[model samples]
Target: MEAQRDRLVTLCRDAGIGQAELLADTLSLLLEGARVSVQSVGTEGPSARLSAC
Candidate 1:
């Protein structure tokens, strides 16, 4: 799985997606997923949510 994913990522780079664009999109998705996971934790205690991330 890791090898296939690496190949796919390499292909995306070769196909002209800039590193910054890739990072931005990846980070956006990750942050959204994190937000949902945090909210699912019953809104208890401190959270690692980063509004500006």
Candidate 2:
């Protein structure tokens, strides 16, 4: 998790994003939620629907 956070911070910095840590954390949670949603539901779930857009 620490390594993932560090990588996210680096990516955010490279992308010129402000509040790197906060944005990384927020996006990480969103990804995690999407992953769990996909797992619990399926390809027809919210995560898949979001990816389609």
**Candidate 2: tens digits of C-alpha lDDT, residues 1-53:** 67887899899989999899998998888777887898889978889966876
**For every model shown, what is its TM-score relative to the native structure?**
0.42, 0.69
Q: Which RMSD values do the candidates have, in order?
A: 8.0, 2.6
| Highest-scoring model, lDDT | 2
lDDT tens digits by residue: candidate 1, 1-53: 34544665677677787784465457556655666766676444223545433
Give the poorly placed runs of model 2, Cα more than 4 Å off.
49-53
Assess candidate 1 and give its TM-score to the true structure: 0.42
| Cand. 2 TM to true fold | 0.69
Residue pairs that clash (backbone atoms under 3 angstroms), model 2: none
Q: Compute the lDDT of residue 12 as modeled in candidate 1.
A: 68
Which pairs of residues have clashing backbones in candidate 1? Answer: none
